[model samples]
Target: MGKHVVCKVSELPPGERKIVTLERRSIGIFNIENSYYALKNVCPHYKAPLCKGVVTGMTLPSKPKEFNWGREGEILRCPWHGWEFDIKTGKSIFDPHKCFVKSYEVTVEEESESVETFEVTVELGAVVVHI
Candidate 1:
């Protein structure tokens, strides 16, 4: 386990993600409005580049084959095939524990910032993602 600095909080806003190479692995760091979540980029199904896939929402089961759309942009779809996984847990919606990708712990920290104009420097805390 190691700490890999991904990006500043301002760099990755909600509905956005960044792929970073750490410890010989490709990890996808996602910003989900209020928090950050990281997942292994490889799809366990067929070794597809999972993070490169589309980020979408989750649908809820309704009455008797009916469905409802919800949790927009909280889901991820594999690029090679249509495999849905929750971004927060890297779990397959159908079988969460059995079929899922690897999830990584993410931490946000404060960083000092330097202003360019007027040579002004301020200790502006930037959001940091650690995996």
Candidate 2:
């Protein structure tokens, strides 16, 4: 496994995502509530560019005639098939146990730490994806 820097922390604000190619693998790096998460860009079903889909919330379980929405900016909606996935876990909403996208561990590295580790000068912090 290796760490690949995706972008500066400032580049991807809260509720934003950036798709990058690291080690010839296309991965989607997301910033949800100040935390970073990485998912494979390819959709598990049809090989669509999953990162290009919309980021949205899910409808929570509620009593009849009531609607509850939660996990805003944490659900990824597939552009082609309308399949929803949890951005944090890359799991499908319908079949979480069997169907899911590939996910990677993400981290935010301080400029000083990156300078020493990667020998690169950064202004603030960098988003890193481990693969």
Candidate 3:
């Protein structure tokens, strides 16, 4: 497994995401409250651009005639079929165990922790994605 330097932490602030191509594959790198997460850009259902979809929360289970919204900014809704997924785990809102999208590991690397081979703006911390 190799680490790909996607972008600087300053570039992608909290509640923001960036779609990057690494090894010819499109991947979405998201920053949620300063924590970085990476997910495959393609959606499992109908193969929509999952990363390009809306980054919002989901409606939780509520009683009859009641409405509740939770997980703010942690959900990704597919634009094509409106399929919702958990950005953190890349799991579908409905069938999380069986149906899901691929997720990658992300880490924030400081200048002192990075190697010389990888070129990134480690001074401000860089988002390194592993695939």
Candidate 4:
């Protein structure tokens, strides 16, 4: 696995995401509810930077055909057309079978002794895309 130091854990704030370019690939690193996740920054629909989108809990209709909605967990919504995706799995809630975003492997290292010691590494997993 290729491990790249994208940013320090302290650089990211909870419920926020940032775009980082590595090897010509745009990467989105997010800190949600104290956990970290990384994905391709570009929206698959139109290549818009997903990092520019808002991060919020997944919204689902209350019933099969109801207008009411409910919250699911950390999801990223594309600002361009409101395409929603589960940040944890990179899956589109609208289309479970065919939509997804490229996800990266993230490692958070916290010190057992010190409360402030921490490190984070972002890596591309088995799915490799050349920029």
Candidate 5:
């Protein structure tokens, strides 16, 4: 597929997400820890807006009857089925192959053309996601 401009780099802040309609398809663009990831809005398990689901990390149990919480805002839970999927890899934690959402390649293009910071010039651009 071709590349499309979803939104500005500043528009989607960290720990937030945006649903974009492109090529007659709905895609969920997420910004996690300044990193961006794109995932098909449709859940492979079922036709659901997977992007609109909960944005929280998973729980790992240290042992039986014990639970450990880590990696906050790095996981997404389906709203309808509660299926957990890694936002970065788009792979289902429980069922890697059988269940998964399509992940798209996302890229960020800064808005500014060029800038000098402490004797260093950097080019700031916007966010352009390639599916």
Candidate 6:
């Protein structure tokens, strides 16, 4: 596997997604709960950058009998089409088998002198090209 240094871990904030272009490819890195995950930045639905989408989670009904509900922290909604996806697996919530984003491998390395600062590597995964 080839490893490409993307950016420093300090550049990203927790629970946020950042878009970075590597080797002419647009990739997204998400910092969630002290861990990192990478995916293609563009949404499969409309080619919109997924980094611009809203980070959300599973919704639980506020009132079991009522239609109102609250978010639960497992999904992300596409900003352009409102499509939701499982953040951990990049699978579409609406259709599990049919749609998914290309996921990448990420590695974070810390400087020997300090644990507060680190570097990040983003590895490209399966390429998905829409026809």
| All candidates: TM-score | 0.81, 0.84, 0.82, 0.71, 0.79, 0.70
Stretches off by above 4 angstroms in model 1 are 112-131
Best by lDDT: 3
Report lDDT per candidate. Answer: 0.88, 0.89, 0.91, 0.77, 0.87, 0.76
Model 3 TM-score? Answer: 0.82
lDDT of candidate 2 over 1-131, digit per residue (tens): 58877789999999888998988899999999899999999888899999899999989999999999999999998888988899999999999999999999998887655433344454568755432
How should the candidates be ordered by lDDT, best one leading?
A: 3, 2, 1, 5, 4, 6
In the range 1-131, model 3's lDDT, one tens digit per residue, is 47888888899999999999998889999999999999999998788899999999988999999999999999999999999999999999999999899999999987566555754444457666433
The candidate scoring highest on TM-score is 2
Residue 9 error for model 3, in Å? Answer: 0.6
TM-score computed on alpha carbons, candidate 4: 0.71
Runs off by more than 4 Å, candidate 4: 61-73, 110-131
Task: List the lowest-lDDT window of 10 residues for candidate 6.
Answer: 114-123
CA shift at 103, candidate 5, in angstroms? 0.5
Q: Residue 109's C-alpha lDDT in candidate 5?
A: 74
> Candidates 2 and 4: which is better by TM-score?
2
lDDT of 4 by residue, 16-94 (tens): 6778887788888888877888888888899888767877764454667666444433888998998988887788878
Error of 1 at 35 (Å): 0.9
**lDDT for 111 (candidate 3):** 50
For model 1, residues 35-68, the per-residue Cα lDDT tens digits are 9999999998899999999999987878887889
Model 2: residues >4 Å from true position, as ranges? 113-131
Off by over 4 Å in 6: 60-73, 112-131
RMSD of each: 9.4, 9.1, 9.2, 10.5, 9.8, 11.3
Tens digits of lDDT, candidate 5, 8-92: 9889999999998989889999999999999999877778788999999878769888889997898999899988899999999
